[model samples]
Target: MFDDRASVATAAGMRLAQAGVRWDVVKVRRFLGLQAIEHIEQPGAVAVDPHSPEPMLYFFVPAGTLADWDVPDTRALNSTECTTHVVLPPGHREAPPGPYWLLPPSCGLTPTDTLHRALERALHRPDPHPHFRIDTAAMRADAAQLIGDAAELPESTVLPQLVQRLRGHLMVLVPHVEDRMRAFARTAETRLVAQVTVGEAQRRLNSVPGLTFISEIKHAQTLARSVEALCRHAEVPTHTVAKAPAPTVGVVQQ
Candidate 1:
């Protein structure tokens, strides 16, 4: 059966204990101040603070058997306040392994590299599912394309419509990209610790499922070229200014 909130919290506490990381209710209070993080109950899914507005973090515990629960892309939490996700590996008989913490941009790790490391450690799986990785790359490429398209749109009646379309595309793609990037960074870190070549590690990433989007590769190259052109334009000085010399400190003779 899927783990409940109390069960997940207990497991999370246990993991933290094993890692020698202390948890204090006081710390939660200190970080959140007077703002109350509300909890809501969702059937077949565990959710905490579901009702709160933007900048609110929600935690979910999967319902039904842990194996049956569809593991969501951990990257989705990157934009949310924070989301605690739990996933079970194959053949597990007991509760799913984690109440892994997911913090948003407001948390310490805002950059892609840092967030990726944290997720890898949290998931702790030897092999990430292939679909997850491929989808992630596709998402990144799609997001980049949408961003480019949005940039190219002329300020006109159709511009708002184009911008909205890009936003919708990003809403779907950004999370997957973030999640897979995290997993990749973590796995790469492990390989690094074992003194493996970075190239080999990347090769392993290439092996992951759904990575067959050759078009995305071409798109990324095009994007890079466009960025280079933009940079060159930016580098070209627009205007020249006259220089002024500093005044001497010594008194001038009359």
Candidate 2:
């Protein structure tokens, strides 16, 4: 394992060794690998299999680092550890359809002791973003306003409770709308490709199971038509409802 900050010419950009000389490959789960990489300073060459069943990370450490490597949920490989060689990308960039370099080969090997400590920390450290929750405060406020307006109307045909339910549905659907709006903004910027812009939109839209972007938009349109009819029947001005700004999505802190 590398100790001093000395740069070595032999290790720079070197590919996997020939049959005789080799390096120990430390295998870690993707998330743990990310955590370990972030924690380690000057982490040496790292490779990733993005298409694997359970995506993996292969850290290139000095040969024999596995002899005393005792980190949990991580495996080390070498000629003596049931494997002779590991396949690696020929170059360092985002090469798809196969394992690629997440961090290309550099000056020195990853320190075994540092990696061990990083893996332990990765296992115990609290995740900053464990999950996501919708911020429905704005929707709730809009529902309250609609309810209050309905109460002031003479023989209001609209049920105040319907607004609450609509708000709940809209709150669920707003994220989809936000995603579309963002996609439009990205695609319209003239700098970004529309194809790439749609990726984020697709990810957000598919996040909720059984919900699709087109279906959500259809439901939102139905809700809009229903609300318009209610407002007309209740003698409420359409202008008043239109004046409310669109509700925004907020990230809740852990």
Candidate 3:
């Protein structure tokens, strides 16, 4: 955007800037329809987008230096015919240098690192909800009977479908969990009536069967995170720092 037209000097200046490794932005030119700078000389570095058909130009300058780039074509662009959109992506200035090496010792753990550790630990931890053990073969056979074609599908394809079916059945399954909990309470009450120890009742209550597996819980949470991250990555204009998805469940982590 040096205040000069495209010529040997302009090209040389661009080359010099590229070689110098300094940076700025993305410029968009809204012409008859939609057009963007699809590719550029530098891979992830600066780029320029200009309308080939029209007198207008679109440039990918480092975020802050839009004013500088538009200088040459300012008069022409500020006229009635031309329109330029200088889209500044999420701005980022390099962090000021500090004793970063000393961080590992001094900064105990960043919030993100701490969260990751907790989620990882939860994921690895024994499934707190482990209770019923399904007969895999029987379950597969039942599934195969219900969906004739799907049953013929390989395990890789079928297992996920089965799991999805099970998840869909959670509303049905939750009632069973509730019934079991009620039964446990009744038994505990009866035992307590018969003068059993409080510690014994507590142990029995804690031993109640869990509704699902630990691995499943952790995996669901992981999957949720991945989906959220994918959405964020897609939603955000640029790939700069975007907020992370909060942990929601377990295997996905329980």
Candidate 2 Cα deviation (angstroms), residue 186: 26
Candidate 3, residue 174: Cα displacement in angstroms equals: 2.0
lDDT tens per residue, model 3, 1-254:
22211112222122122211122322222221011111111122222222235323223222233332322112212212233323211112111121011011111212222222333333343421234322333323433433435534334444333443332222122222333332232334332232222233223212322245544333333332322222222222222333334544541311
Residue 41's lDDT in candidate 1: 17
| Residue 26, candidate 2: alpha-carbon lDDT | 83
Best by TM-score: 2
* Candidates in descending TM-score order: 2, 1, 3
lDDT by residue (tens digit), candidate 2, 36-86: 765787787777776678778887776666777678888877666454655
Which model, 1 or 3, shows the larger TM-score?
A: 1
What is the C-alpha local distance difference test score of candidate 1? Answer: 0.27
After TM-score superposition, what is the CA distance of residue 42 in candidate 1 from its true location, in Å? 29
Off by over 4 Å in 3: 1-154, 183-254
TM-score, candidate 3, is 0.16
Q: By TM-score, how accurate is candidate 1?
A: 0.21
lDDT of each: 0.27, 0.49, 0.27
Please, what are the lDDT tens digits per residue for candidate 1 over residues 22-54?
110111111121111111111111112212242
Model 2 scores a C-alpha lDDT of 0.49
